[model samples]
Target: MLEILFEDDYYVAVNKPNGLLVHRTRIAEEKKEFALQILRDQLGYHLFTVHRLDRGTSGVLLFAKSSKVATLTVKAFEERQMEKLYYAIVRGYTPPEGTIDNPVKPDKDHKHKAPQDAITHYKQLGTVELAIPVGRYQTARYSLVQVVPETGRMHQIRKHFAHLRHYIVGDKRHGDWRHNKMFFDELQSPFLLLHAAMLGFEHPVTKQYMEVHAPVPQNMARLCTQFGWKDVLPAAVFPPASEAL
Candidate 1:
């Protein structure tokens, strides 16, 4: 069943689980059902996607019941009126908080950069030191953080942070492979730690403010407990703000 976060006559929002595709793409045709199809089936109604979270990303994803509503919701996203908060376990202890403004574009063939106007606000959640016999060291350091991507671009958050050398854990393509394998095998990590934690925007039909939050996954919760972090995140996920245009 689709894990609905919030729902109303105008639209529906839900928590997208990891490894679930938002829709059918050429690369993942072999997959049976997608989040869209599953949501529609579970809701027993037609629904249109407002925005997308990556396949590996888990959290607040919205869909509209009507095409007209879908158009309006998508416009809100394009206008940057929606605020998204994400959580991830990063490679190491990152800076306290800062904005990353850098130009992003595809390289000659592959790989992209974080755009110049791109801004990502991040705050450290906590840190942990894990002991594992690897290389010349028997331990490694990691940091947890809450990230807010001010701009929505192709792989914006992933690319931007990767360039900062704070690669998101388990980001195979845009991440450090050696480290990924190390964590997955030694630490027994199932998938990436990056999660879509919150989403806020105006209700297109109601013309009212809307904010939604999804709790961290069980695996992440367990990891945090192992590190002695008991809900370091703020109780209030997305506070109301003026709609950005």
Candidate 2:
């Protein structure tokens, strides 16, 4: 079942799981299930999606209960009033904090031909040096980071990470193959480590400011515990004060 984050008269928000689709799409056929369908079934009423989360990323996804609110919420996103925050496990120790100011555009190099104009900000959360015996002395070190994007672009976070040269741990399409193989073969993880952790926006109906938080999924939590980092990582559930509703 999807974790209900916030729900009310005219809208609902949820923490979507990794490997689950936000809705139907041509590229990723609806093989398993979707957030929208499950939410409607659970709530016993239809809802309209105001925004989305990546199929591989799990976290806060918002929906509108009424078409009137949905239209306004969509405009809010288009006007950049809504804010989204994310967290991800990367393959190595990153800088203390940084921002990827580069504009995301279509990846002319990629055959799939995805869109662009993506910009994101990232900060180092904590470090985990799990030197698993892949073959020899070449064990690995990884870092967990929190990401907030100003503009919502397709594959923005994944594409930005690759541009920085420290790609996310399990991004199959945009990550390094050697590390991916190592983590998959050794750690037995099936999905990307990226997650959508939080969403902040103004309620269209009530005009109240809100920010909803989503906890790290089971797999990422397990990884942290396995690496002896349960307490080392900062509190994800309790966001910073500025972001608090």
Candidate 3:
């Protein structure tokens, strides 16, 4: 069953687990289950997706209860009125904070297509060094980063981190194979380290500001603990509005 993070008359959100598709797709024809179907069955009502989360990402996912609400939310995203934050464990230490302003190709199938503008801002929350050797080094290093994407593009975060040569741990398509194997063998973790930690937007019907957060999943939390980063991973990625004020 999916975990409901927020729900109301016109909208609903869930903490979508990694490895679950939001809905059926031609590429994943063999899949028998999806988040959309599961949530709809659980709630006994139809739902419309407002956005998407990669199959390897786990966290806040929103759905609209009606066509009108879905249309409004979709427009908000297209206009960049919604704020999305993600947490990723990347190989090697990242800068204290930085912005990746690079253009990315729209799809791998169309590699020759014109690249679209992609901008992601990130802040390093913590760093760790492990004794496991990887590549030419006798020890491994990693960083936990909070990412805020200003523009959405296909696999923007994964591609941008790879462009920086700080590949995300367990990112098979755009990560260091040696490092990925190290995590699987040493930590028994074979899942992508990127997570959609929070989403902030306005209520389409009420026009009230809102923010919803999904706590770090256990797998990532365990990895953080192994790296002595337990202190840095916050219980809630985004504080309540009252606490922020």
Candidate number of the best TM-score: 3
lDDT of each: 0.80, 0.80, 0.89
Q: How does residue 134 of candidate 1 score in lDDT?
A: 41
In the predicted model 1, the residue pairs found to clash are: 102-115, 102-116, 103-114, 103-115, 103-116, 104-113, 104-114, 104-115
In the range 1-245, model 1's lDDT, one tens digit per residue, is 97888988888888888889999987889999899999988978899988998888888899888999999888988888998899888887898887888766763455554334677888888898788654556777788888999888767788888989988888877887766888788767767888898898878777888898886666666666677665576544322221110
Clashes of 2: 5
Winner by lDDT:
3
- What would the per-residue lDDT of candidate 3 be over residues 36-88, giving only the tens digit for each residue? 99999999999999899889999999999999999999999999999999999
TM-score of 3: 0.94
State the lDDT of candidate 2 residue by residue for 93-191, as single tens digits: 899999887766664556476455667888887887766754353678788888889898778899899888888988988887777888888888777
Give the CA lDDT, 0 to 100, for residue 107 in model 3: 68
Candidate 3 off by > 4 Å: 237-245
How many pairs collide in each candidate, listed in order?
Answer: 8, 5, 0
Evaluate model 3: give its lDDT: 0.89
Q: Which regions in candidate 2 have their CA more than 4 angstroms from the true location?
A: 30-32, 107-115, 133-137, 232-245
